[model samples]
Target: MRIRLTDVAKGRRDEALPPTSLAYASGEARLALAETEQRPTVLGLIASGRMAPDVGTVTIDGRADAATLRRAVALVDAPDVCDPAPNVTVAGMVAEELMFAGRPSNPVSARRWLEAEGFGAIARTPVADVSPRERVALLLGLTALRPGVEGMVLVSPDRHGGHPAEWWELAESFADRGFAMLVVAGEAAAIVLEGRAPRADAAAGTGTAAEELDDLVAGSGGETPAALDSDLVDDSEAEPATATAGDVAADPAARDGSAPASAAEPAPEPAPAPTTDPAPARSGEHDPIPESADPDPTPEPDDRDEPEGDR
Candidate 1:
């Protein structure tokens, strides 16, 4: 069996998931990077044919049949969709999953199943308290039991806080058992896995799995999708680019630009006034009356007329 997603996307332009394309066939495990709280689940849904992509296609064996795809693929532990409740006990979860698989679901049966599956000690433990590695193994094991399930989309196992290699090995084991596996994880997990690929390849003595893993990481461009980084989106909207003081001062056109100085840049300082010396005082002439000082109100008597009358 083969499953392919061609530019599959969900939500408004870059809201939930960016357009992505990937394909995996039976006996192959692939990883896809999806950050943010909603993206992993969204990708898992689209990959498993549980949800339709807003702008792409998902095909099984080169046929676009949602019903058959849904039947053949299982979406495991998707947040807010099929995840076992945090408060639910391991025994309870096991029993429920057993019932879904059309097997005996009584408490005794659940216990026996747990013991047989090497999870007997954790039977009474709350699912939330289960270790990440054990939790993933148990969930994936149970998912494999479901009838008609040939492939699985495991969603956001990294969120549970285990090393990527732990769960990745489990996925690879399932794939080696002829099940197509797709693990939807965050960018951090993908980076860790990519970094460990060389060591893993050496340990396995065959580079096939590591090479395929490298291809998966490379296909994602090894970077967080712009849409998936909510913080970046929020920051761009919260703080717009503005002209700096240096920019306004250096570019005369910026000062005269349509954007107001108060809005786009700081106002420039006022230029100093030009200085000039007053015309040299005229020779032997009283200094030109000060432009600003007021003249005395009392007037002087005419000295020539008064003296002539007395003589």
Candidate 2:
């Protein structure tokens, strides 16, 4: 099964929802790791017809409609979404669900279903009494009873406190039976997808399907697949150089509507200043005057007898 989400924006980032855009190609078991509470778990709900995306389209196998999506998607053990009453007995919950769905409502039939799934021992136990992992497993077992479900979305399986590998195995088991699985988990989740590969276009806008889906759930804007592809292309090519305000003000070429050289030429060094002799100090000065400053005033060329005596 293929699920694609286009420019979908929802919820407020300030309130823990960020705008997002992305495309997701589903695997047998896929993992959506999110840093925030908004995750693919919400998308699973939208896909299953429980909630509507504020914007954008949710298509399964290239079709979008309530009846089709509802029939094909199922939520398993999603806390606060699909989880049954904690105090409800396993058999009791199953019987009620079957009755609501217009299926066999007999508690005995529900009990038989549990036994067939190797959960007979917990048939009479209240869900709250079971371990978190067991609770999730039982919920999954119940989900299997729904007819014609082609996809299962498991939300925050890590909250149940078990190896992510265990959840992966469970998802794969469902996939082996031809069901597509999506596991929404935290960054630390231990999920392992079979045949998982890095998307070549990962550099494209939208970080992950979960983040983009949250963007939709948070009521943000969404983009079509084509627009997203274009964004990827734009990102790959280097962006044209842009001058900052200071640069533009400083560069004459920028002001003249012409591109300046990619690299600016270094400025020429300044010439050294000329040296000058200082004036001689006056006779009454207190500070000592240097000999160069005084310069012997041309020695008052004593043309007198001193010249004859020395000669």
Candidate 3:
């Protein structure tokens, strides 16, 4: 998906531009970093992973870089990023460098070491008088003291002017030797790489490109009235139906094809009166039958054989 960086930075991060991709989504820092100039160092550090991004993830190759890059990559800022000892000569310091390197003993011979490292005459001079590059070289040399330094980064190198060809050729050689580089340049830089700009007509045409999916399907006779189902549900709760056949017959849609949704089924008439014999009634409320209706006149003999109720 193509995320709108502007909206994300302004609406989410609040940064002007993103420091590394992470800060781009920061709801606050983004508002401050959007300019072509006047950027903060934390932004660069965030990109390098020494600091954190406010929004997106940082990756190298395909793996996340925030963890790995912080240790592997070093940033080079031009000139004077250190302090010096006044009591010691350059050679004395270079000889004692082994102590600072965690060796602390069995130091290099100063006279022989100074000559071997191309600082023989200058070795006797105090470090405070040396050029920035000399100090940088000292700092850079210490990186290798760690025993497994694979590479280094130099921001502004000496050979960038009339010697551009030679310097770039050296960079090409370094790349061939598998050194990853990040070179920064000043205003007077002479080297150039060719690039092409997109044609105006092509870009404009693409920008105005239209979508016909909805319109084409709509006009293709599928989304028209004929394509719509008449049986589809209507809005609102249906009322308990009291409608009869005459009311159902008056609906135009029902006449055309649709059914009358609220029409009720016709009520059935009472069944014809059932035929049965008339039943006779009792004379008194408490009596079962009148004595006059007795058909069996004779009485059966009592079971006990005691005549009448004399006892």
Per-residue lDDT tens digits of candidate 1, residues 225-269? 455467557876898777779988887877787554466567788
Sort by lDDT, top down from the best: 1, 2, 3
Compared with the true structure, the alpha-carbon lDDT of candidate 3 equals: 0.40
- How many backbone collisions does model 2 have? 11
Could you give candidate 2's per-residue lDDT for residues 173-243 as a string of tens digits?
77667776766677566324334522212322435655454444333234446665676578657665567
TM-score of each: 0.63, 0.56, 0.36
Residue 73 CA error for candidate 1 (Å)?
0.5
Best by TM-score: 1
> Which stretches of candidate 2 lie above 4 Å from their native place?
13-16, 20-27, 37-41, 100-102, 190-311
- The true-versus-predicted C-alpha distance at residue 206 of model 2, in Å, is 13
Q: What is the lDDT of residue 139 in candidate 1?
A: 94
The per-model lDDT (C-alpha) reads 0.81, 0.62, 0.40
**lDDT agreement of model 1 with the native:** 0.81
